[model samples]
Target: MALKATVLKARLNISDMDRGYYQEHAFSLAQHPSETPNRIMVRLLAFMLNASETLTFSKGLSDEGEPELAERDLTGDITLWVAFGQPDEKWLRKASAQAKAVRLYTYGGRTVPLWLAQNKAALARLPELEIWEFSEEDLDALTGWFERSMTFQCSITEGVLYLNNDDESLTITPIRIKDRS
Candidate 1:
């Protein structure tokens, strides 16, 4: 009998700034590049909206009832609020440990402790995730993946894993390893 397979396709579109500005630039849970807050937020949102379990992004308005810094250029720092799928407070602490130019904070709405994020105890989690810095080599590898699209598949027995892409699509399939020769 053929192995039962679950196919999933994911699409990724990187920001134009990233394509024009940095080295095969791709953001990850572990780090971000030094750039403007708005651009950074765009980058984060591009990834989070698709990958994060829960998240939000917004800006405060000025006392004049205008959007905060409406008169000013959109080049200033802006705070970002993110909440991964965990019920703890440590993730915020960890993300804030380093002195990044932009502010990254947890939502008062709900918090996910870092231990749960770190310990892999959460039922919904990101594991076996990798952030690939776009490079000629990486592009070559992805080209290979595309050329062999018909044979590709991915599965998760326990956690929520996302395979990010700079410019590509994918099909994920869940199957028993033993069924493969």
Candidate 2:
């Protein structure tokens, strides 16, 4: 028998001073068997960073065509597509064409910089795409606060993120690799 995805529930209170956006979101995420806790936390972090009434998690790892998270308008037009980790130039090209905005969160300690350097020219062509890179240590620390049923109080100020529960807390400042306007 194939392994089933684990459903986890989370309630997040987000305060993003940088964007002046504040909202509460309830999420039900299906954790794939092969997905690590760190990656799962990254998904949650991505959601918190872009919390919106229309934002939602997609089929995630199970769907190749869909982004990990997306925000859509009432007419079902995709406004934003959020992807995790490194994606190839082809995928980035497709996403930029389909959505109004596309954002990628790249993680991995030393490998992330090298990957960016190698793909810089190709990535720069997509003016509507944005890329942010997080360190492995920050992700590891964020994963420590993960739980099946959890509540998080998240704050973002001056481009720095702070997430915490009752027992643990994490602070991360993501590096912006590409910002095309």
Candidate 3:
């Protein structure tokens, strides 16, 4: 028999000073059998970074044709595509063609720089793509805050993110290595 995906629920109170977006979202996400707590926490971090009323999680990991999370317009057009981890240049090219804006949150520390060095030239060709990388230390810190049921207070200002889980708060600063626009 096939193993089922585990369901995790999260409540996020987000305050984005840069975007002037503030809201609270309560949602559930399915964690695939092959996924780790690190990846799930990264996905949740991505959600808080780009939280929107219309943004919804897609069949990520399960579907290669869709983004991990996306914001669609009323016309059913994908406006923003969000993805986590290191993605192939070929797939990013496809995503750039499909969406008006594409953002990649790449983790895994030192490997990210090497991966970018290998594909930076080709990636620069896509003006819609933005690549942000998280340090392994910071990712590990964020992962420590993960749980099956959790609540977080997030605030973003300038280029830094502050995530508060009860009494403890973690600070994260994702470096932007590529931004054509």
Top candidate (TM-score): 3
Q: State the local distance difference test value for candidate 3.
A: 0.89
- Per-residue lDDT tens digits for candidate 1, residues 1-181, read 5333222222333222312311122222211233223223223323422232222222321123221111122454222222222223343333333212112211111222333246443322222121112223322333444321222122222322123444554322211111101
Whole-model lDDT per candidate: 0.26, 0.87, 0.89
The alpha-carbon deviation from the true structure for residue 28 of candidate 2, after best TM-score superposition, in angstroms, is: 0.9
Best by lDDT: 3
TM-score of each predicted structure versus truth: 0.19, 0.94, 0.95
Model 3 lDDT tens row, 10-76: 9999999989999999998899999888889888888888999999997546887898899999998
Residue 168 error for model 3, in Å? 1.1
Candidate 1, position 135, lDDT: 24
Point out the worst 10-residue segment of candidate 2 by lDDT: 59-68
| lDDT tens readout by residue for model 2, 47-147 | 88888888989865878778879999989988999988888988999999989999998897888888888888899899889998878888888877878
Task: Pick the winner on TM-score between candidates 2 and 3.
Answer: 3
Flag regions of model 2 displaced more than 4 Å. none
